[model samples]
Target: MTIVVVFIIVLIPAGMVFFFHHQNKLKLRARLMREAVRNHEFTFHLPVKGLFYGEKALQEALNDLGQDINKLVAQKEVESWQKLTRVLTHEIMNVSTPIQSISQAYLEHPKVVGTSLEKGVRAINDAAGNLVTFVDSYRKLTQLQEPVISTLRLKDFLEGIMELYHNITWEIGIPADTVLDTDGSLLRQVIVNIIKNAAEAGAKNIECTWRDSALRISNDGTPIPAEVRRDIFIPFYTTKSTGTGIGLALSRQIMTMLGGLLELSEKADAGYHATFILKFEQ
Candidate 1:
């Protein structure tokens, strides 16, 4: 009788403790989900360390849900942006083409000749050219396709890109011995975009280095403001007065597709550094 009573008492309290712990964990997870939603962040996984019963199963379920929601959101956003780009480009081209044609006709008209009219035509032509360039940059953003990856020599590929930026001196620290398997053209685009931005930011000297499967590009220029750095990779976010703000976003997309990451870090003393981490293929 004594033994039976003791066993019952122990089992009952033990079970209660276990149940309470599980319930608390579930509550914590629910709180995290709510917080994530409030912050406009996609929450796809439960808290890493605070998981309750069936941790693996819950994680898998949450991951699936998160991915599905993210996919749907991205699809809708892309469709909307594409439609906007098409409409805007068409409308702008329509306006620009007629102005260009009229300006040329007026400039060449023998019946009408004046210095003021000639100056007006030149101004119209210059404005049209600027608009065309702006539209072209947006077109590039919307029409990016997936890259084709292959084994490529890192040194040669980087040198080819640096050669294009002839105005700025490049200090390369890449190992000639290292080779990488990646999308050569896409990688080149990423590097070019960074270097181009650096040049715009008053960077006279640019340094490119590769170490431990990571590529770091540093430039001696004005440091990017902390507020702008947070959203530098976001679509339509630009620090430049005339920037289209899609280059960094596209580069990040390409890197993500290639199982890599693009990150920015402020230099301790001066300038800023952007790093691309390429995962080695298994």
Candidate 2:
């Protein structure tokens, strides 16, 4: 009886010590997570090492939460920029239309005709005309019509695009019977825009197929730079000197309007510099 009592006393104190240590560890992890989220570090990760099975589950959940937060933050940023673009484009259109008209009148005036002022007026006219045209391109981004969804035949759809671009070698691996319910016209526009951008980037080979429950188009050309990835969807952000930078942003907006997603795959397969994924609503 005496020996049993002694054993119980020692074991009880040891168990309590471990319990407190484990509790403190969990508390620390939670505190750190809150701090990370507060600082907008949504990519933070916590390892599930030396944890109780139940605690390991909690850790896994927390890790997934961080990834979810990161996605939500990205979506919000895109939405905020899209809203700002709409407002800015509206204002620009309102102002540039009058400027373009006034410049045209100045160029046609007899007093300015065939003189140095004509050259200057012509410059203003051209500038205003180009500005109006550029703003017109952005109108598609803000004024997207409601999608009329239809059953899209994958093979036929891609074949049409393939026939149009002969310079770039195309390898399409999607099954023949694979059908998608989407807005066919809008979807076509998005794919065409992406292909044109890739062609301009010097892509010699382009491949499109289905992967991970989505359509993935990958190209062997200039990879998107890391610096450009973050702002790739922002309106008017372009790498090319003549690029209006409306393609991807407009594509993303179209997909969003269609209850789908269009995104750049960060880690592309070997031999491919860039990959884009299109996931439709299920």
* Among all candidates shown, the one with the greatest TM-score: 2
Off by over 4 Å in 2: 1-75
lDDT of 2 by residue, 1-282 (tens): 999999999999999999999999989998998998887666566889989899899899989787666656656766876688778888987888888899889888898888889888788878878988887888777788889988888878998989989999998989999899888889988999989989988999999998645788999888888877867888888989988888888888887777767778767766799999887655
Query: lDDT tens string, model 1, 1-282?
Result: 999999999999999999998888777777877786675445335545655458767776886676456445544554565677778988998898788778778778875466667887878877887887778777765676776879888878878887788888887778887788888888877778878888888878777777645677787767777667657867677877888888877676666556565556433223444433333333
lDDT, candidate 2, equals 0.84
Counting clashing residue pairs in each candidate, in order, gives 0, 0
Lowest lDDT 10-residue stretch of candidate 1: 268-277
Best by lDDT: 2
Q: What lDDT would each prediction earn against the true structure? A: 0.70, 0.84
